[model samples]
Target chain A: MKKLWLLLLYGLLLTISSISLAEEESAFNWQFGVGLGVSHNRNLLPAMDSPRNGIPQLQLLFDFEYKNWFAETPSLRSGQLFGVRSGRLLDDFTLGYRLSNSERHNLALIMASYHDGFGYSVASGDGISSSKLEGLHNRESDFMPGLRYQFYTTDNQLLSLQVNKDITTHHGDMLRLFYGFRFEQHNWDLYFNSELSWYSAKLVNYYYGVTAAEVRSGRPQYQSGSGWRWHNGLVGVYPLNKHWITELGAGINWYTQAFTDSPLTRNNPEVVSFVLIRYVF
Target chain B: MFFRYRLLLLAASLFWQPAQAEALLSASPSNCVTLQQGRECHAQIQTAWTISQPLTVCLYLDEQQLQCWHNTASAQWQWHFKDMQSRQLILWQMTDSEQKLHVLATARIEVSWVQSAHKKRLWRRF
Candidate 1:
């Protein structure tokens, strides 16, 4: 399975040069900002309680183009890799060379980045019974090489397709399709994003499958197949003059049978929401 | 399963590029021409021209170029400066009847615009 994913990724990289080439533009432009927000996280484990935690948001936007070589952030939706709480702040960080960029449409980028994975350990007094989810090994982080294609339907709408293969440990692969729309009214800027993500069998099994050694009487050894996850959300930011802005967002996630059927997971969909206020500087 | 149709979708979208109007060679003042808050000193393009004719006198604002053509053998041509905007880059180009282009002159004015104390930047990624 890993070999197949590697082959596909290699093929994608080979086609980058044939796609739209990037135009040489000005260089070394960047933006920086900091903010804070509060999130209402939905606990994945039914026996455990989720927390309302305050999270800090920091952004460093720097991009430099020396001829065709370019490095910037990959535009990806924020998602939880393991259960509901385990997430990475730099999920969309990217370093790549632009294959092609045009004014009207079509952008092709080839990038390499670190892909995140999940690890769950039930400690004492953590409010969960580890015995029920025995033998579920940790999914270590891996470096992935990927191809991204973005279609700008307009200034306000976009469609993106990305395929990536993990090159380090588990060698799993993922393909995602995303659609985004932006609108502004009365000083409020609103953005809506919808995504469909497909994970390989190895990825699903490694993260959710129960091993034979750790399986108790109620926890049968299980193997999960490939699965799909759907997520949709809306984010709104209202800028008050030039220095202050307020942001709010909410999203829902639905896991397929491949993940929910596992003994370690529940059947309920997850809901995550947050609100933020920032002083832009 | 979504991967099955990716190539097909991409191929279709490649053909959907919208055509843009030709850019004009004319120039205008940015909203920031007024030295006040929320305004920056910049020149905006007003028209685009495909120069296919001979020109005698031309006018320029900032880096923007506007051309002119004269066909009559005897014509009275004179240049005029009508209330130039602040911090504007001005240039003039002349062309002979044989369609030879030449730079006539260039000049600039200085203007100060109010600067905001709060720093702000907005960007989007997809």
Candidate 2:
């Protein structure tokens, strides 16, 4: 219900902005297509092998700007999470107010989105209940409000930093930094983004910590502390013609000690990758 | 990149006309060029005309008119580019004796460069 109201409110704001700005030549732009993707990730329980699945993929590239205010979702290549079977209707949704854009750098106040928490009930028939990680409460999705800065460097390199705190609840506070290198030649474009993400203790604990009431036989109580994750990815886009492009990308996340110590986490390095062919209209 | 492509299409739309009275203009391949310092590119501009009257066609780089020709039929020009230090909007204009200048087509060329990353910056949206 809250999410619905938020969506309606955002629509109303956009309509109001559109009506107020009659002289400016601003339009809402969007690009969309469909493809197929596959990803492999560790199971929620320890001692279990990684699970891989294929899924239908959806690609969306959208941007709407009114004066200094803008809402944009660059691409699925950036910091995105892909599921094996399930899918995301949208990628990273960022609404921001540009403070200034000079030759060297750009600054803005941004509100960014974080993925939902993961929790599932365990059945006795299923194996690998080794450390007892059942009955854990689920954590809701987080919307983080924060500030971001981007610096353009020589040789087509970019550095970005973002710090945000969850608005839905104070459970999570995050700091993310990225260094990206972009290259373009002929009809091919490639980008490599290396990122480091810091999760506050409260945030990590809420998602991975074990609670007393949920504790059961052989499931000892566990408390997770603050940790960091290293995420790196590469995305390449090749034009097949005037209107079609083939996109392929792969990303992996390396868990920190605190995160791996959690009874729910299995793999140290989780892998996510995708491939798509899209036509622009 | 998307903005550059969109601008090229918008420039083409300005010259759209009916089949009977077509005054169409088009650039072969694309109209936007991005190059590093001391680099250059080439493009060919072609025009379609139905009336047999003489018309003046001019090509403008930034605000300066580079060349002009008086022709009775369709006209095509080979463009050679060099020494572009910044982004430039190139325009092709068509004018009759009545003193009306019409922008028949347009293109953009930009010198590729990147700023040093040592500068301070901050921005966010959510």
CAPRI-style class, candidate 2? incorrect
Tens-place lDDT digits, model 1, residues A164-277: 887667677888898988875434567888889998987777666777865767668889889988878877766543455666777877889997888766776866666656
| Global local distance difference test of model 1 | 0.52
Q: What is the DockQ of each candidate?
A: 0.06, 0.03
Distance from true position, residue A273, model 1, in Å? 1.3
Error of model 1, residue A92, in angstroms: 4.9
Query: Could you give the interface RMSD of each candidate, to one decimal?
Result: 8.3, 9.2
Clash totals in order: 11, 16
TM-score of decoy 2: 0.60
- For model 1, what TM-score does chain A reach? 0.72
- What digit string (tens of lDDT, one per residue) describes model 2 on residues A35-55? 344433343334333232343
